[model samples]
Target: MRFGYFLSCEEYSPAELIEQAVAAEKAGFDGIWISDHFHPWNDEQGESPFVWGMIGALSQACSLPVTTAVTCPTTRVHPAIVAQAAATAAVQLQGKFVLGVGTGEALNEHVLGDAWPSEDIRLEMLEEAVELMRRLWSGEVVTVRGEHYDLDTARIYTLPDEPVPVYVSAFGPKALEVAARIGDGFINTSDDADTVREFKEKSGGKPCQGGVKVAWADSKDEGIDHAHRLWANSGLPGELSQVLPSPKHFEQAAQLVTRESTAESIVAGNDLDAHVEQMRSYVDAGYDEVYVANMGPHYLAMIEAYGRDVLPQLRG
Candidate 1:
């Protein structure tokens, strides 16, 4: 499986993200996955830069292929706007960009005062958005009056030689079905073999990608501490992540998440064996690519370690 580095916009500044992307390339990572968020999951994570701008800067900084871990085109931003931005990014990256999209969460999508839609409605919106984007990417004047969006006589002037690939993110059956129907590829955050197999079967063997977070520090305890402090929300159960409307609510909910749970859920510290095993899980589950994100302040160290020790082991 191909290995990539995940750039967390929630935790690092734009400059730090650029530095990490450069480090990741030098570290022998194959590509990059950048999160698109309007706010940090909580205040402790601290930063969220405009993802499009970061993609622009990234194109100049590194030759690595880049994918937005997922962007929501149905809300906060219109599909037309997302398509234009993505096309521009594709051109900037010389067609090495993939637009990974999802129905999105209330945390980022509701900031425009738009009421968050239910799962079914959100899925419907995503389908329509994908259709709109693909049409726009055709480099032809497109006019559409659709269920979730309306487009006037619009055309993307700046275009890549090939259309940007759209990878759909899904964590449930309904979303998975939608993804299989519309996406060029599939994306998930977990290494669930059944889900990956199901998508591949339905999508005629489309590529699947997975992402995992690890906290790399000098010791296991330090890593756990950092993971708990910054990403405890990751442990919250069920639909809490999708429904919670703000960082404050996430912080309130994350209060119930324990450091032990964070340690259990996230691979922590300098255990190269554990890191390799975690990544291998995705491969074993049938993922074509896996991206790893480092939590806390020691990301540079983590990147270097992965290059020198972990990645070589995974390859072997």
Candidate 2:
């Protein structure tokens, strides 16, 4: 399976993000997944730049394909605008960018003070958003009115020479069905075989990608501690990202997670066993690729370990 890396919304400067993308590609990663966030989960996490801008920068620095895992086009940004951005990015990356999208989390969507809708409503919006984007990409004037969005005679002049495949990020059954129906590809962070299988079945044989986070270090304990301090917020699944109004909420929930939880969730302690186990689910589920999202400070070393200590065992 192709191996990739996730660029999360942690403490990464723009230069560092580009530097890490280059490092990941040089170390043999196939692609990179970047988080699209207006704010990091917490102040403790800090530093989120406009993801489209950074994708452009990565295009200049790294040859690997990029996916924003993911950008929600429903409320925060109009679907037409996202269409333009994705097309432009595809041009810059020479057709190596996937427009990964979802219904979005509240932290980013709530910025306009728009009331967050329920799952069903969000799915409805997502369907319209996808439809809108597809129409816009045909390089014709799009004038339409939908339940959630209305566009006048709008057109995108700077269309990409190549089409940007749209990848959908999904977690639930209904959402998975939507991804299957509309997405060119599917992306997920979990390594559960059954879950991936369920999604793939619904996806109608579309390409799939799985990504998991790990904190790497010489000591397993050190790695778990780092994971707890930095990524514990992820434990609260189902867009807990929507309810959290500010960084302080993340800070508070982050405290609820312990080092043990992280250890249980990820491979650690320089043991190839854990990483191997992590890859098994996606591999067994027939994913086209599996990505390792390094969750701690020592990303450089983690990529090195994957290239040296990890990949060989998987290939063998």
lDDT of each: 0.95, 0.82
Per-residue lDDT of candidate 1, residues 1-316 (tens digit): 7999999999999999999999999999999999999999999999999999999999999999999999999999999999999999999999999999999999999998999999999999999999999899998999888888988999999999999899999988999999999999999999999999999999999999899999999999999999999999999999899999999999999999987788889899999999989999988999999999999999999999999999999899
- Candidate 2: tens digits of C-alpha lDDT, residues 189-220: 76667766777677667888877787788889
CA lDDT, candidate 1, residue 125: 95
Tell me the deviation in Å of residue 96 in model 2: 1.1
Weakest 10 consecutive residues, lDDT, candidate 1? 257-266
Any idea how many clashes model 1 has? 0
User: Candidate 1: where are CA atoms >4 Å away?
Assistant: none
What TM-score would each prediction reach against the true structure? 0.99, 0.95
Q: In candidate 1, how many Å is residue 160 off? A: 0.4
Error of 2 at 294 (Å): 1.2
